[model samples]
Target: MDALQGFGELGLGSRLKRISEHLMKEGQLIYDHFEIDFDPYLFPVFKLISQKDGITNTEIFNAVGLTQPAVTQSIHKLTKKGLIELIDDDSDKRRKIIHLSPKGKTLLKQLQPIWKSIDSVIKSFGMETSSSLISHLNSFEHKLKTHSFSKSVIKSLGNRHHSIQISTFQNSEAEKTAFYDLNEEWLRTFFYVEPFDEEVLSNPDKYIIDKGGHIFFTKLNGEIVGTVALMPLPKQNTFELTKMAVSPKHRGQKIGQQLMQYCLDFAKNLGLPNLILYSSRKLENAIYIYRKYGFVEIPVEPDCHYKRCDIKMEIVF
Candidate 1:
């Protein structure tokens, strides 16, 4: 009944292209469901740009194994979408180097978890042995027909979210140590720990708890994998959502978002006037998440608490 199946090995290239297109279409649907502005066709080029940090058009063309014109067009599309920017090379003013824009970095954070889910689902399909390329293709196509790829990915993400648990600060020493450890892990990874950070993290009870503030931790399968603090600010009826960190191994599982949502809900229930947060502009993905949660950028004072605080944001209840 199917002419392509009848053609067999002779149509291998065409069949592969057809399957690629199908997967891409499903990828677009997945992005749509998540409200992400992206084109699945540009994923190869986009992914390359993200990994390379900075690259040239020629390099992208070679790396992606695409025609020069195709690479150029993909670059144009990414630029138009405000996901990337081209800057003049310092060595050669005529040469242009590509880098991810702030929006692109934000999109990367949103996409990485989804990418993992996609990889997991596709890898599952390839687990069984197949006799030939044609046999594998046939089985893959059949599985696609029977299963909704986009739905499966969404379900996978949902299951991950459901498995996580949020808990308030407890008196356990291990829990207290997690607060310091998780915060220290990220600080050491991205920025060095300041004396102020050390003082506060080392004594959360004296600084945060006794001062009418709250701390929250995220547990994944009984492991404390993330922590956040809602510390009372100098301003009346306000709190600063600070010292938030997710364990390195659990970074991509939306643990940060969960802690953020819990803090917002906790603040709301207490009838707080507003919640403020200080952050570095260098943390673009984190800033994007703040904005996503309805936090608006506010001016940072000349004497802000942390030296690394370049930006301040707040959300009113």
Candidate 2:
């Protein structure tokens, strides 16, 4: 393993790329087995275009996390294959937007079940492993942006990494205030708060704790920075993770990752087999974290609590 993966995270560019290439080969085989004319390395670009039709090339680079040249080459391939088309923007003739051609749309429609199978198999991987991979990747990227990885390694080469403390709500006024403040800050930023949000945020003691649920908070430097709730379902052994948020000042600092880790551990400790969540597509960052922890999007419930929820996902352990 040392020969295969040297120096751990401090030196892992080649190792990560090696693992990625190996996985990409497996993914290509999956597509080939289904007789789909797709390249696994280019799938992210295609999928992003499908999800965000008419999105610009720059947007694809950001959303797909690929180099501009890589996205450009894939787009060229798709266009040449007649699976996608680049159209000049009506508002800005200089800019071209990417969207699926009729051929791509119909072909994807036909491959829906194949995609479902791949998604299911990936979700079958260990929840903790998948979650940690996504969490660490996000943390590395965040750290890299704020301070280069090489610099960070020199600064804290031998010391333990910064960690957050998790605490269960104690019904203190200050804790309740933090809970409401944190959740409200995020809700207002992305979506309007609904009546149900008010009902739960205002009285977690009644709606959550007293009703077989637990709310956990993440504290950093003696301040409550994030909160999450695990509400037991009416049915047995089921739960929902709701009202999760971290301070904007502390956002992208891996506070949410700690909150989620606590929730996942607590759920398993209590013999829960699955954890569900409801969110919107607009909350792409949140969705990525959820999926990292093995949450797969399920059909939306007809009577979900939040009006803003367009996507429902769950991790079935």
For each candidate in turn, the TM-score is 0.62, 0.52
lDDT of 1 by residue, 177-272 (tens): 999999997787556899999999999988899998999998888989999999987654578999999876566567788899999999899988
Candidate 2 regions with alpha-carbon error over 4 angstroms: 1-163, 235-237
RMSD of each: 7.7, 15.3
CA lDDT of each candidate?
0.86, 0.72
Worst 10 residues of 1 by lDDT: 29-38
> Mind giving the per-residue lDDT tens digits that candidate 2 earns over 71-171?
89999877866678889999999999889976577556645555655555444332233355545544433333454332322232222116678889898
For model 1, the superposed segments whose C-alpha errors exceed 4 Å read: 1-61, 66-152, 156-158, 235-237
In terms of TM-score, the best-performing candidate is 1
